[model samples]
Target chain A: MLTLKQDHSTLIVLSVLADGPSYGYAISKAIAAKSDGHFKLTASGMYPLLTKLEKQGLVTTSWEEVKAEGADPDATGRRRKWYTLSPKGHKQLAKHIEANRQMQALLDAFVAPAVNDQNAHA
Target chain B: MKHTHGNTPKPKPPTSRDGIETWLDVLTSMLSLPSSQRTQVRDELEDHLRSRVDDLLVLGKSEAEAIRTAISELGETAQLARHISSASRTPKSFRRFAMNATFFVLAGSVLTASVSMMIPTHTNTTLPGATEAIVVETAEVTEPIRHRFNHEREPVVDVLQSIATAYGLSFRFSDGVRKSPFGKTILDTQLNTFKGEYTLKEAIDAFQARMYMTYGETVLAMTENELILMTLEEHKRMQIEIQAYQIPSWAESDDDQRNYGFSIEQLISTKHDLEYTTIQPVNGSLVVAAPPEVHAEIISMAAQLEAIGKSMQAQKTQQRIEQHAQMTRRIDRLRAEYEAAKSVYFAEREKANEFSNRIDELRSRRLFVRSNDELSKEQQEALQTQINNLGEQSKQQEITTDEAKARFERLQSILIDAESELILSDINDALPIEGMNDSKDEMRTVSIMGTANMRSGIYQLPEAGKLTLARFLMAADVQDPNGKVLLQRGGVSEPIGTVGDISSGTIDSIVLLPDDQVVITAAD
Candidate 1:
């Protein structure tokens, strides 16, 4: 699998949280699953990125209790910190995606002649 | 993992497992954020690692292999920490910059203070006169002239002449103006101009300011017919009047007074602007007229002289105070030594008096005997005259104890020899007793066989007494109570001498007592 550029790490984290509220592990798993294992987000890399995004007000977090199945009713169960995409995060993600699309269009234009030349040689 | 019933302990969650804890430790150490954020990052990383490990275990991997795989998928600790550290340090870098800037400002302030302290207070400049002229000219030349010129680095003199011609004014230089130092300075200066309208005075003033010169009216006249361009020294005249009381003491005498006025003029002459000066010293006052700039310099010189005088006076006072303190200390030391010497002198005098009194008592009881048959009548008379002379000598004042002791010893020996001659005569023909009373006289005596101890190698008698025959005989072999012989008269087996000659004109009697004591009996 090919690794994505480090600058795009923020965009990737924000995009994963755009679906709904998610914890750090879920966010990393979603990014890897959405990119089809091409851009695997590591736990170490994903958490600081989530913290940076939260500090920038692009995401908000709260602790949620996730209990095991058939556990005692009196027990509080395990606590997982959940991250949610903010309004600012939604706007930033849209702008970043639009910029990525524009860059891709420019790359395609630049690569199309090269591909045509290679096809003519073939 | 298998779970047991009732009493068995609950298994730990995947997040708290050993492999997850190890990975979190490495990540936490690498992250250089604030403690709260660092712990948050560690907790999030632990949760994510647990989820990955559980997912791998569900895919049929063993627990150990699943934990290892989950950890391997994360990026290198150093790279991840760097990214997080850079993100966290954005605000910190700004604070760091502010701190560095504040340090530089404080350091600059300290450096400026140190440099200002090292620099001298006095400043030499022609700015005061030039600045005054500039203000005046700038106000007068508010309506600019329509003169336009284009020149590429032309001589300042030509530029000034052109500006003068344009303004319909004549420019003139003094006789030695071009050859003087000021002329050399003006000649070296150059001016460049483009198309512009500028007043002649304003242009000249601007050019002069660069060379530290002032453009103003000459002392002789202020006319439009000839425009004069003189150095700053040729500008204005100033007069100073000094009162009679303010004159220094050295200016009192006629010759010194003349030299004093000359020296003031000489002080003003040191400057380049000494072409015109008038110093008149009248009986009660002094008046000076010179360039305005020279007035300031003279005032400064006067103040400096006053400061030097005050400093010298203060130094003299300090030296006098130190000398007085030193003299006072010396006088105190000498007084203490004199007091100590006086006490010692009085104590020695008192001891000498005690010895004198004892000698006088001993001489009173002593008797001298002589045989007239052993000597002719004339010889006897001569001996009697000598004894009388010695008695008279002993009566005089200022006699020391040692002198009195020698006289007593002489009298005793003379009496002893005379008595020996008398004893050899026919059974003693009337022993003449001169000092003895008509009635029986009392005598105080002490045995020298055992009495007091020796003091400074001389035995002191136990009792005060006159030297009778019994006392003299007992003192022949003197000793202390301890049986230590203090003085043995003439040595062992020596014949005991008589208490002789009390008849030689009543010579002072000699006395012997215990413990080396001796007495001289003087006649009343």
Candidate 2:
């Protein structure tokens, strides 16, 4: 609410966990993919968010090893941890998704509509 | 208490053979975080992670593997340690912590009270309107007695009641009301006397200050009027004694007089015409006019005092500004300092000017100036030159404020000496009550509005042909056909004697001889 935390960290954490369960490393990787190398939420920033999110009861956590579909790559991919969502976390994520969708819709409908018109006219 | 938040780093749980105790210890630590954060962080993390570990075991993972995976997913606890430790370093953080702790304590107390009230707990309950009975000791001393008391009442009231009890007093209890002593608490007990207990001297001093502060013109008018009236009365008595030929002739005495009473000159003279019956003078300090030197000195000393008062006020104002300057981090203080310095400089200059004016006034009134101004025609030009030179010297050196101040002090010293001489002269010049009393005894002041004649029992004379109510007397002219000249018998009562009834005759044509008495009367 205070914007005291970084938006990238919050977005990465929310989106990665939006699907199902994930651990800290998986969230970091997911953030990298989503930003397409444009942004990276560091471990330093990511760990603090996990702590705060857990404090706010937005996410619940557990531990499980990552298992590859085909041949298991050495221990790096074999036993990585995971974090997951609670019911409260699911609700928060839904709200976050809805807010993001509305913001995009408004941006498309109201803001820069003139730019689209100009392009069409040209 | 431990704050085992999610990012909180923990040393590896001791490999206790008793697993439950270790796990329970971790749970307890987890619960120690702030309540709002604890439920979310501790309970959710513990429950979710514990179930997840159980699930992993159910899915065939070992306990250590499950625990490790769960902890790793929660993130490193070192971050919590680092953040909390760094936050504790600041003073403001500690202040916030204290404020939060106070809020939590009050909230906890309120929650406990509400729970107890709803459950009707008997613990620590105070019954409504339950009066506490306490032992109250009563004692007495002399005029001011010391007392001691033990009660559930307020400590201030405790002391006050102790005092009141020492005097055998207490709160006056009434129906739904209580009353206590009006002057129960004294911020400082040293000050005891009031204006109601003022002495004559104190009253005089207070009256003097009050008169000076608020009623200056009134006091001045009253003072001048009293002095002028006394002088006028003194002159009046001299005139009466002179006209009656009952007073001693004026004789020049070279020595100064002390309290002009019935002097040796007045005691020897007598006349049958009139004599003083009796008199008395009030107790007063007759402040006679001082010699010119003494008067000049007083004027200068008064000026010096005024200057000193002004300079002290200016200095205090300057010093206060300086003190304030020490407190300033704000820019306005610089402005204040400049303003204060300017005011101090001007105030000092004004004091210097005031002293100069007094000196000039006194100098001009002195014998030296008198001689200079009243010099002969041949030397008048030379005197004027000297006056001009003195004036120039006086006006020069305007910046010698300290010199003026020192000279002001010198004038005060001269004033002190001259004042002593003036006070000493009071012993001779002032009319002491004894002397004034003697003069009053011999001076008869009779005020007659009309004629006085006793020869034929005819004194009041009524005027004719008009409703005149007043009367006057003059010597009658028997043959002049008009009563205008003085004769042997001065006047008569017109309504009864020596004049015809004007109502029945042409009275305006009446004439009288030289020795005839005349009476004039008027009535409305």
Give lDDT for model 1. 0.48
Instruction: Report the lDDT of model 1 for residue B295.
Output: 42
Off by over 4 Å in 2: A1-8, A63-81, A117-122, B1-524
* TM-scores of chain A, one for each prediction: 0.91, 0.69
**After best superposition, candidate 1 residue B460: deviation in angstroms?**
99
TM-score of chain A of 1: 0.91
Docking category of candidate 1: incorrect
With candidate 2 superimposed using the best TM-score fit, by how many Å does residue B343's alpha carbon deviate from the native?
Answer: 99
TM-score leader: 1
lDDT score at residue A67, model 1, on the 0-100 scale: 55
Q: Candidate 1, residues B402-518: lDDT per residue as tens digits?
A: 454555455555544443332222111112211211111233323333233211223322221123323232223222222222223333322232223331223343333233333
Q: Please give, for every candidate in the order listed, the TM-score of chain B alone compared with the true chain B.
A: 0.28, 0.13
Poorly placed runs, candidate 1 (over 4 Å): A1-3, A70-77, B1-17, B78-82, B85-90, B93-524
Tens digits of per-residue lDDT for model 2, B1-524? 12122331212222212222223222322221344443333333443345444444444344555555555433333333233222222332222222111111110111111111111111121111223311111111112122232333233223323322333334221211112221222212222222232322232233234323321111110110011101212222222211001111122232212222233123222321123221111122112122222222322333454457557656755664464344233324444544555565566678666656766655565556456666565565565666566666556535555555555555555544543343223222221111111111122211112222211222222111111111112112122122222222335433332223332234332322223343333222
lDDT of 1 by residue, A35-82 (tens): 554555554456556767877899878875555445566776555678
